[model samples]
Target: MSTYLPVSGWCYMTNDLMKEIIRVAVEAGERIMKIYEGDIRIEHKEDSSPLTEADRRSHEHIVSELKKITPEIPVLSEESADISWQKRKSWGKYWLVDPLDGTKEFIKKNGEFTVNIALIKENALAAGVVVIPAQKLIYRADINNGAFRRNYDGAETKLTADNNLNTDNLKIVGSRSHQSELMQTFVSNFENYEIVAAGSSLKFCLLAEGKADVYPRFGPTSEWDTAAGQCVLECAGGVVLDNAGNKLQYNTKDSVLNPYFIGMREYNEAVLSWFKALN
Candidate 1:
């Protein structure tokens, strides 16, 4: 593997490197699945989120493998995110990972959890790989390359977002665990839309593959939670926008928490106006 310099852009993300990252994510997912099948023990984080042995095992495996693959680049995983802002502020390029997203759903045995890994270049998502362990699905994307969905059998399909937005009957995807009043208000604006409830980063994959048209996230989320999925959606001709209607970015602040954002198959001015009117 070639050593990548901490450059300003995504020039270092080659197809081979993307493949290696995908392999790492898939292996991490395999580790998680082993725990998922057995008697599970769950712990609670200080923030009250569910933590499991699978998260720890996956985090350790991914961090160790990523170091071997790109020793020069730094990695920041949700499991080991104790690095100070002073240290993180200077990182022009780094790996952002969420070993197990939708842990609540994982505990529910709903098969909606995911492993998310993303490359951040100059505070923007350069590449990402998301693996659904139970479903044996992979979604990957890069800044230059388009998005793809790969099956366990190695069959791959190029993903394209459904750019058409039907106001009368929209296909909207929402969080299965974190529904809030703000999200309700946003959805209420559309009189005839159907809800497509999903957990973790699968909502983004749904938009990437044209299965859903929009995802309105009104509740709180961390940077790791959205980065990989956002990359996949954006590379598939979609947009994940912050409240200000700008592209959602990463690592630009002290907190890892993300602001309220919307994920759509494509940029729609009317939708933006509707979201803005809510505020």
Candidate 2:
């Protein structure tokens, strides 16, 4: 892989490479849409999560294309077989992919599902691409460069999160399909707030585009599910922090399950207090 130094002094992915990553994710979304329009046969994995042909097809296509794009870098997908920690612990960087996020939304035909792909460098997000196939919206970001969103018609716009946001009337984004008691409690603490129920990584995209102020996730999610979105949100002047107010990291342990996290344009003392209380 080639290295490029940005003004941030971070040797990260270049704009051209990020563009290629977005292309791969968009292509995978095209594959997913094909199966989504069909009978939509579903299966269950060992964990009992719903699985569909779209997930498998998208995973295969993403892994193959990423390998061809950078054969030196390893790729990990939600559908891939578990690799031993002994082998993966030493990996400095890799591709983390969730071919089909929001399977529940897909099954419900709500057009909230998405395709996610991220590049992880030493457990930190280096670059990411999130494609909402149903919404015809695409988002991509890298650590050094800023974030951007592209429409289906080929028009692209730069994304900038609102750092100087008003916390009085918070626009909170939550899951449309998945909900939890903890999440309910977190929201209840806020006297003045509006909730936007969305599915998939669109929660993060909402924050990146300044449409939403905060997103608190208390349920289970894999690294692949959040890594891509984290990159986009953070690059857009936002942050995704764990309960401890620390930024989320990937591939530091054997398990892929991620800790509870809050996605926000900027850290709010009131919001962090609520998250800390829950923890």
Best by lDDT: 1
Residue-pair clashes per prediction, in order, are 0, 0
Candidate 2: segments with Cα more than 4 A from true spot:
1-11, 177-179
Give each model's whole-structure lDDT: 0.89, 0.86
Kindly list the per-residue Cα lDDT of model 2 for residues 27-110, writing each as its tens digit: 899998988888899899998999999999999988888877777788888999498788889988888899999999999999
Residue 150's C-alpha lDDT in candidate 2? 89
lDDT of 1 by residue, 195-225 (tens): 8989999999999998899888777899999
In model 2, what are the clashing residue pairs, if there are any? none
Question: Which TM-score value belongs to model 2?
Answer: 0.93
TM-score of each: 0.95, 0.93
Best by TM-score: 1
lDDT comparing candidate 2 with the true structure:
0.86
Deviation in Å, model 2, residue 235 alpha carbon? 0.3
